[model samples]
Structures are given as C-alpha cells and as structure tokens.
Target chain A: MTLSIVKNATCTFCGCVCDDIELHAEGEKIVKTKGACSLGESWFKHHTAERLYPDALIDGKPATVDHAVEAAANYLYDANMPLVYGLSNITCEAQREAVFLAEIIGGVIDSHTSL
Target chain B: MIYWGGNPAECHPRHFTKYSLTQKGKFIPNGRKDRTMVLVDIRETPSAKAADLFLQIRPGKDFEVITALRAIIKDQPVNPKSVAETGLTVEQLQDLVKQMKAARFGIIFFGMGLSMTRGKHMNSAGVLMLAAEMNAFTKFVAMPMRGHGNVTGSDMVMRWSTGYPFGVNLCRGYPRFNPGEYSTVDLLVRGDNDAALILGADPGATMPQPGIDHLARIPTIVLDPKVTHTSRISRVHITTAATGVSAPGTVYRMDEIPLPLRPALKSPYPTDEEVIRRIREAVAKKPAWRPSPNGQMAIV
Candidate 1:
C-alpha cells in the first residue's frame, strides 16, 4: 500500500486546536501522526473511512438517512420550546448551521461553555 | 506566568513546550530560565512539578483568594485571619503581589476548576478583575483554558450571528440573552425545553442526573461521527464525518484564532454542516411559523 502524507493538518481534539501536525494515511486509516501530542494522535488514528455503524438510527432502530432527518425536523417543529445544544466538537460551518436551525425553529441554542 | 486552577501538564500537554513556558519569544530571550511560573489549585497535580511556586488553596475559596489578591495589589488593608481561611496567608499574597508587580509581562491561565465550582461565574469575574487591575503595575492578562474542540469557534459564530455568545434564545423571533434560563444544563434540569438537537457533544454522559433524565424524556436528536452515549438515547442519530479527520472545515484556538482543517482520508458519511443544512431545509418546507407583521417587533 502506498503511503499518503498530509502536512499541517489541524487537530480539533482540544481547545488548543494544534494545526502543525503531519498525518500519514494508508488507504482508509491514518497510520502515523507527527508533531501531535498523545491526545491528538489518538484523535487522528481513531477515525477511519471505514463504515463502523449504521447511517442513521431512529428510536434505537436502523433507519434511512431521509427518514431520520424528517423525524428530527418533525420533532423540532412540533415542540413549543426546542433546544439546540453542543457545539464543542464540531466545526464552525456546522455551528453556523445549528444557530440558523435554532432560529428557524424558535428554540434555545447553547454550547458546552454554559455547562 | 500563573496557572490558576488548571492542570496544563496533563490537560494541555504541549502548553508548556509549544506555547507558554519553553518558547523563546522576542521579549524573553532566555525562555524558561528568564520566566517564573506559579500555580494555584486545590490539590497538587502533575502541573505543580513544573511550577516554580505552587499554592494549594482551599476548595470553594477561589473568589476569596482572588479578592484578597486584588486587595493586596491595591494596597488595601486585609484581615490576616480572613486571608488564612483561603489556605494562603497575607504574607504569601503580598509576596505574590510583589512578584506580579515586578514582572515585565504576566499572564494568568484559568481553567474549569475556577469556572465550574461553587462560585462559578463570580470566581471567573474575580480573576478577570484581578488581571485587569494588575495592569496598573505590569502587562497582565487572563484567559480561560477552554475544553473540547471548536468550542471557541461556536462562541465566535454565535456572537457574530446572534449578538450573544452562548445560551441564546430565539423563541420570540429575536435573540435574547439569559444564561441561567437558556443554558442547556439549566434548561434540561428544569425540564423547560420540550425537544432538543444535540451535536458534537455527549451531554448524556456528562450532564447532571436531572438533565440526563430530561434528555431521555424529550425527543432528542444527535448528530455525530459514531454512536455515542447521547446517540444511544436520542430519538434520531445521524452519523456524520469527523471534523479535522475526514471532514474539512475551520476550527478556532482557545485564543479565538481560526485554523483550517485538512483531511487525510475520505469518509463515507456526510459532514455535520451538510446534515444540519438538510434538516433546516426540510423544516423550511413546512408551513411558516412567523408572527404576523402587525405583531412583529421591529429590530431597533
């Protein structure tokens, strides 16, 4: 297998958000990570392109992505006071989307900082 | 440099080597040799080994300690007996104030130990106030040691979008700010919210018992890369690509500096941004929930 190297890959494991790590990937997995601490190394190595779980789940049962999305939307729309929480581990793009969703659904939006 | 209520040695392993202590900066030529490190916490963690001076304070006394320091810096009279209750004497506080005033540059990095304790925000406020007052003697600043990835980014995004950082409410069609009322933990524990959409965090594992029970009672939706603790209990769990690993986007440092993520491998799942946008689009397709223009409040 050919090894592919990516330089200056960012690690979002902690608040430091170290961005100088070097990632070495083989096929679907990250084999080695240089310049990253132990936490960051495990973060990079833990995630792989391989499918580990079902795409979506509804009420502990396997369901299609479309069905799950609709179910989620229906729940949020039907509720009087819905909440959108937990933006700690995701990216800024997703956070923006979450804020918009909260606004449209007339809900409260909070992050881990409040905890 | 002062590390207050934080264990950087174990929590942020590279903080000493990468950012604060050992780095040779323009002002400090000798790096570690020229700088003095102080640590203040309830217990002696591994980080105490790295500090030149360690002060083990009594738990729940952060506010009192910080206030005492503030008084000492301003030359205000403080009762020695009262100071002793904080697990540090007035003499020790005087010496610390001396060192702080003598330094050319000073910084205080406070962590969750100060923020999540009994006094909570008041403790943080005392630290910030102390740092601001220290500027009268030297260049001193204080920063919180934020936890989790992109938490800072979420604060930034929410600030620019809604005019508030966190604990924002838009139920009235405009942004309203109230922490104890709108914050997730308080809302969940009080059973105020009827439904929830949780992303990027596992509150089921970390929240208080009442909050966890409320989440279980509500229709909770989770979006994450794996089937996490929250996912198992949620009504809908959507698998998404992991940020900074298989999904590319932006993350912010604790200092609020933005950094771009470069993925090394392709993932089979959609990104959180895509999933949220799809959910929003689906919600938009439903009938509008907007108030009539006659009852609409104007944005002043």
Candidate 2:
C-alpha cells in the first residue's frame, strides 16, 4: 500500500487542524484516508451521496439557483432594517463577501457571539 | 490544575490527548501522573471524575469559592464559618491554595459553564485574575474550552474584519462594537432586524428562551451541511458541503493558531463562499419589488 500526501484539504468535521492527511485512491475512488481523527474520518469516509444543494427553495420546491438568489437578494435589499448573520463556519472569503452584502444593504450583521 | 471549569472530556474529545494536561511538559516527564489535578465544580462532571481531589462548590458559588482561595493564597484571613457556603471547608481550600502556591507548574481551564452563567465574561475574568495571582508564587496559566469547530476562527475573523471583536454593529455605515447593542439577542429582542442570515451556527440549540422567541419572528436564512432545528424552520434553508471534508477552508484553534482543513470528500454542491457570493451579487443589485409602508412587499 503506497501513501500519497494531500495538501490544502481542510477537514471541516472538527476543530483539530490535522492537515497532513493521505488519500489513497484506486482510480477515481478514495479507498482510504490516513492521519485523521474519528470525526474527520467519518466526515470524509461517509460523504458518498450528494445531499441538499445551495439552490433556494420556495415552499419546499426547488427554485432556479438564480431565482433563489434573486429572492434572497430581494428579501435583504428591500428591507430598510435588515440583519445579516451566520458566517463563523464559512471560509474567510465567504465571510468577507457576507460582510460586503451587509454593507451594501445598510444592515446589521451578527455571528454566534453570546451578547 | 484540573482545579477549575474546563471539561474537555465532554466537549473537546481529544483535548486531553493533545494539549497541556496530558501532554508532556518540559519539566514534568511522566505526563498526568507527575501533575496534581484538582477539580473545582458544582457537580461531578466527567472530567472531575478523573481529578485527584474534587472540591465540589455549591452552584453559582464559584466567585465566592475562588475569592476565598485568592485570599488564602495572599496569606489573608478567610472566615472559617463563611467557608461552609462553598461546600468545602476552609482547611481544604487552604490546603489546595498551599499546593497551588507550591506547584512547579499549574494550569486552570474554564468552559461555557462559567461564561454562559451569571458571571459571563466576569467568570473568565476571575479565572484569568486567579492565574495572574498564582504567577506571583508559582507558574500557572488559564484557558477557555471553546466549543464548535471554527468558533475561535470566527472570533478571529470578526476581530480582524472589524477593529472590535464580536457583537459588531454596521448601522451607521461603520463598525461599532457594543455587546448589548449589536448582539443577536439584543437585536432580536428589540424587533430591530427584518431579515437574518445564519451560517454554520444552530442558534435554536444554543440560544436562550427569549432569544429563540426573537428568532422565530424574523425572516431567517440558515446555511449548514446537516439539517438542524434552525435549518428546518429557516425561511431559506441552504445546505452546503462541510468545510473540511466536502469543502476546504482554514480554521483557528482556541490558542489563535490558524490551521488548514483538508477536503476529504469531493462535494458536488456549491461551497459556502459560492452561496454567499451569489447572494451578495443579487442583493447588491436593486430589488425587483419594493416594500409598502405596512412592511408588505408590493409587486410592481
């Protein structure tokens, strides 16, 4: 069994930053991954199926991605008093973008900070 | 010192295996065996069960118990009769103080149990003060057992994004951080915000009763990998790939150490960044509909 090093993969499953993980693949399939915690292992091993997509939903029915985005936009942009929250578990890039959205809408942004 | 609030066993499963407690110190060779573990808590927690001696203080009496110990450490008189309130005798506290003062190296860890209770930041402030005082006689340090995978990361992001830390306000076209003024609970309570976007956090599980009530009234959008109570009730429930597994990102540890997360699974779904990007683009442009004075959107 040969081990191949995978870099820049962020294990989002837990807090521990175990970076140097090896994904042993056999042709397109990742047969095994080494050097991750139990939570990390489970997060990586079991994510085989595609779950919910980021497309917006209107009354539990799938709406076009553009339509969903537009609806969300309308919700925030139309409101004179809006609050943009929840960016703690996203990438630094996403967080920055969310902040920009908040700024453009003249809205209040909050995270999970207990105040 | 196991002497305080941090319960790693319950929250951070690998804390003992990774950090100061079980990890070998430069001076202490034998790991946990060489160190004296003292647990000070209201009830017998899983971590406390492992302590060498458990000083069970009455609930909400941490400040009193700690203050008495601080007095004893300073060679001041602690009323023997008053010590009864702490559930531990004065002699026991004195003995613990003596050991703390004489220890080669000691560390105190706190948890949300302290930060979330009546004391809030003051409890952590007290713990930090205690460690500072201990430095006078012995080498001691303190740490908070922050939960959530990227909570510390979130804290660092907010601190750097805005000059101030959490509870930031962007109301006046500038970032003004006043905890009660800009906090989620306060904002929700006053019925100030018309819309909300929750990312990665499940406030339904974590918030207080009033705060939860406030959330139910707002137009909430939740983004997460799994279906949570918040996601179930959210006006817009957008599910994305997990950051470290399906998606890749960086996170910060409790010690403010930035680390990269490896993507273990290939996600066919849009990243949180993509979701936010699209939303920003849409919102930045003018909305198609306008709201009437009564708060209903009048379709043109």
Off by over 4 Å in 2: A1-14, A18-49, A52-54, A113-115, B76-82, B136-139, B286-300
Q: Output the number of the TM-score-best candidate.
A: 1
lDDT of 2 by residue, A1-115 (tens): 4434465455544454545667654432346676656665665666642654545564356666567566677777766667776666776667777777777776777765453
lDDT (10s digit) by residue, model 2, range B152-266: 6767776787776566766555788776677787777777777777887787777777766766776777667766677656667776777766676677766778887665456
> In candidate 2, how many Å is residue B137 off?
4.2
What RMSD does each model have against the real structure?
Answer: 2.5, 4.8
Q: Please write out the lDDT profile of model 1 over residues B21-118, one tens digit for every residue.
A: 99998988899998999999999999999999999999999999999999999999999999999999999999999999999999999999998887
TM-score of each: 0.96, 0.82
Q: What is the lDDT of candidate 2?
A: 0.70
The lDDT of each candidate is 0.92, 0.70
